[model samples]
Target chain A: MSKVRVHNLFISLDGFSAGTYVTADEPIGDARALFGRFDGRVINGVHHVAEPITADRIFASAWGQGIGAEIMGRRKFGPQSGPWDDDDWRGWWGDAPPFRTPVVVLTHYERAPLAFDNGTVFHFLDADPATALAFARELADGGDIRLGGGPSTVRQFLAADLVDFLHLVTVPVVLGEGTSIWPGTAGLADGFDIETLTTGSGLTHQFWNRRR
Target chain B: MSKVRVHNLFISLDGFSAGTYVTADEPIGDARALFGRFDGRVINGVHHVAEPITADRIFASAWGQGIGAEIMGRRKFGPQSGPWDDDDWRGWWGDAPPFRTPVVVLTHYERAPLAFDNGTVFHFLDADPATALAFARELADGGDIRLGGGPSTVRQFLAADLVDFLHLVTVPVVLGEGTSIWPGTAGLADGFDIETLTTGSGLTHQFWNRRR
Candidate 1:
């Protein structure tokens, strides 16, 4: 079955998925160090080194495997918010994006779908989590739909109970403030059995699998 | 060498040290389940059963190994707010309080020190973390002073950068709203090297050793 999966999402020790004062200068707020621990491959991302395989690299490399399409928040799509005026701004990743699969970017301001060279397509959708998941599910083509998040997006899909699995990498730093997963996720463990995987890099990968 | 310590402190997957709405009916709010993971002694407490050894039991048993004196937030002392009207209420523990050493309870209202049958003597002080630590260190008699917490209290000590070691047990559960440890703890990880120990019981014990 095509499951909705949130893979390799790194959060602060304080449970903040992001940090404060996010701008082009610090696109992910002050969460640069926190997210830096991932060094994993996102849909549209960097870091494709031939370094010896560590647990981080293994998990980071496995990020794009199996998943077909992706659904992300507008924030994850770009630093721009509200009406997108920057015509040249495609995404954070230059040229070839990481998520080679079709991606549904949840946004209020809709635009025509964008196509990248490496099978990466950015489809902007002005819809809720359920509506967006439906759109992504179809594009997934029987494969799992990866919920690429900036935290709020993950929380939305998780709130709708649409996520089949959520893989969270807990970084040991404290960001203090940012988009958090626990804001509305009370009783999240009720449906999922948690699996803990620790790496030599001090990153604890927690998998929340929806129980049958 | 006597080092300050926080042992067996349980935090939810979402980083909540305690849940909201802490009352007599629910002292830790919805965090009862989260904290229930710790089977440690708390200044003369329960569950002294000699069952087969478990990871939690091991950590709980190690809790009082070298601790001399203890300092805790007013919340951890009791559920009563404002002033202490109940002359009969010693603490949550049934009689022979846990700490065989002097205990300091941080509170706004000062009270005459209450002595227990055991060496556990409760002193109410409206003092800051440094002041309390100094008092605790003296009472510790060159032994380690345990920083007993309810989240916010730990945060206060952590913010002061007085905590030499923090042994946190990561319990895989989410209590959406509660007192958190992230706020005002931005540069905490800079001085500590975190080591994670996962038990068969699904509890991840994180030992943060403060850099010398």
Candidate 2:
């Protein structure tokens, strides 16, 4: 059986997922100070979980403990204007992006296949939330499938009660207004259980595992 | 009299102000996300003591409200190994950086005077922390001297008990090891008192005021 998980979804105090004037060039605002929380090899270890590399290096002692597949919304894939123009704008990351394993991108517009040399293939699914979860479950192969988000997508999955676990890295600065993960969403309080709460680097990393 | 205040200084769980591998190109790791909390213009009007500006706008109407001058350490100004280079590499911001006031750089190496067309001047100070504070005090003209940090410089001033107030944005990510602001060489617990704490966007922003 496969499990669904959402990881590293960021939010601002005013319920905005991102700043309003955000563009492809400036995906994040005041990014330097906000991202300063993860600087050393520690973050790299976690990032490598999705990146493509030799199996030895992928599973090497240097890499963090656990991570399976990645799932994100199209907004995170690129700027939100045109449908997929060309393959040139793959993402912020260069040729070999951070995520190497199977990645699922949720979108309404239909697009052709986006294949990269590093085993990264952009699979665009127009199916509903249930269909996406089914595909993720199949891909998980008994492992955990991460829900990489832009807030709107995460809210949809959470509303459906499809996520099994969540790891939120909450940054301190607040935009006060933008896109938020919790607004207009409901039913999250039912089956969710907080597994652990830890504090480090002035940031609070919370983990919640779904209760059966 | 110039009052010195520390604002938006982030810390790690291990007491490292920033991780070990801070370079000139990227002074603070994960800094983008750290500052993301303040990116939105909507929240800017509410949370920020300062007003928010559009992305295209460089100068804000409330640029010099609480901030009288900008202060930073040498490493944050440029690379660590090189001697005092020319003003080519002023602080990260380009020619017309955001700060429209006297920007001070704390450095041991003295170089030729560098001036920008905009209201930014790279004033290098060789004197001790007290001298630098005095200069900023005079420059502030009764306003607060904002302590823009790189940790070590902040630690020095904090050790001398020169800081009047401190604002720490606690992001919720654990690097497991890195530079810390509070538990630095000089114990921050000794003189600083946490005056206020606000939680939003999964981050806890703490304000520490000097006991006086």
Candidate 3:
């Protein structure tokens, strides 16, 4: 059976996953500070979730953990404007990013195949959340399929009770406002069984394996 | 007169400010990532130096132009077993983590201070290089003082020479890492004018006047 895991999802105290006024200069707001300790690989994870097609698979193979495929939304791919421009704006990561698996980008905009150096491809799928998950499972081979999100996209899956495991890295600072993971939604559980909680530097890393 | 300016410091490509072995649980060894984002604070002069203190005056007035203090040092206050822990730890941050004006800590240990909460007594001085500049002037009153540091501590100040002004956020990252700053013991340049630099955060602003 295939399972979906949301790893390294960062959130502000106010519940926002990201700030509203996100420009190329300041994509994640003060959240960038939260990522100060991450290396290029983890940093690439953000872009991988947004546009999995452009990721490098050989690097994924190197992990040995075997991440089969990725899933993300349109806003994460790039600024929601017209057709794909010159491809100059390569999803934030520098020339050669880390994701090497098949990436399914959730989008309403229709576009042709976007290619990059190495063997990375950008596939724009206008499928529903279920379809995206199914496609990721198919692409995963026998490995695990992951859901990469920008709040709204993840909320869709969470609302339907799709996510199996979640790891949220709770940073100390609060943004006061931004994109939230759980908004007006109701019926949240009383408590979650914590799998692991460790403190490194100042950031707290917590993992929860849902008890279904 | 002396001034202090906090600038982003360099950290290892890894998320570590220094190395791992050092922590409150085990304060020593390879803990460089602790200070990786030191230079991030220079732009717009927005340095984020965390201080753990109990003095309200220090917290209420560590920012603005020309008025503050600088506090730092390595093993001066860290784990006991490390080679630098010659005696009881008395962090250079002073009885209140220095910086009735501003404070800068350059170290490999990631231990929170023993006391800090009421006033601005003790601040957790991270590895931001410009912190030294921001601290000196703020605490200078009109006179200049520099807190000499171990190797990593002084190297940070020398790399930017932001220390118009110099002080050691030096504690002990290692007891036997050869020479503290850089390998050679050569002194700084003659024309390297030592003047003061100053700025203010909501807390206590600082001053960094030259020492000529």
Candidates 1 onward: DockQ, in order: 0.01, 0.01, 0.01
Q: Estimate, for each residue in A77-186, the C-alpha lDDT of model 2 and write its tens digit.
A: 88765566665777766787656666778888767757788767777777777888777667655545667776778888887777776655566676655666786556
Name the runs in model 1 displaced over 4 angstroms: A36-38, A41-50, B1-212
Query: What would the per-residue lDDT of candidate 3 be over residues B1-212, giving only the tens digit for each residue?
Result: 34433222222222122343444553335544232223221222211111211111111222222334444465434544434344346543345433344344455544554444423333444456665455445545563333434335656665665555321122212332233444332555452432221112111111222344
- What ranges in model 2 sit over 4 Å off? A13-15, A29-67, A195-198, B1-212
lDDT of 2 by residue, B1-212 (tens): 45676655655334445666666566565443444444322213211112111111111112233466877787666666457445566656667655566767887776755677867677787778889888877766556677777787788888777887665656555566655555444466666655333333444545555665
Instruction: Please give the range of 10 consecutive residues that has the lowest summed lDDT in model 2 chain A.
Output: A50-59
Q: lDDT of all the models against the reference?
A: 0.75, 0.57, 0.47
Model 3 complex DockQ against the native: 0.01
TM-score between candidate 3 and the true structure: 0.43
Which rank order by TM-score, best down to worst? 1, 2, 3
Query: What CAPRI-style quality would you assign to candidate 3?
Result: incorrect
lDDT tens readout by residue for model 1, B52-110: 32334434544454567999999988898997898777888767777878999999998
In model 1, what are the clashing residue pairs, if there are any?
Answer: A43-A98, A43-A99, A44-A98, A44-A99, B43-B97, B43-B98, B43-B99, B44-B97, B44-B98
Question: Is 1 or 2 the stronger prediction by lDDT?
Answer: 1
Candidate 3 wrongly placed segments (more than 4 Å): A36-64, A82-88, A117-119, A188-192, B1-212
Full candidate order by lDDT, most accurate first: 1, 2, 3
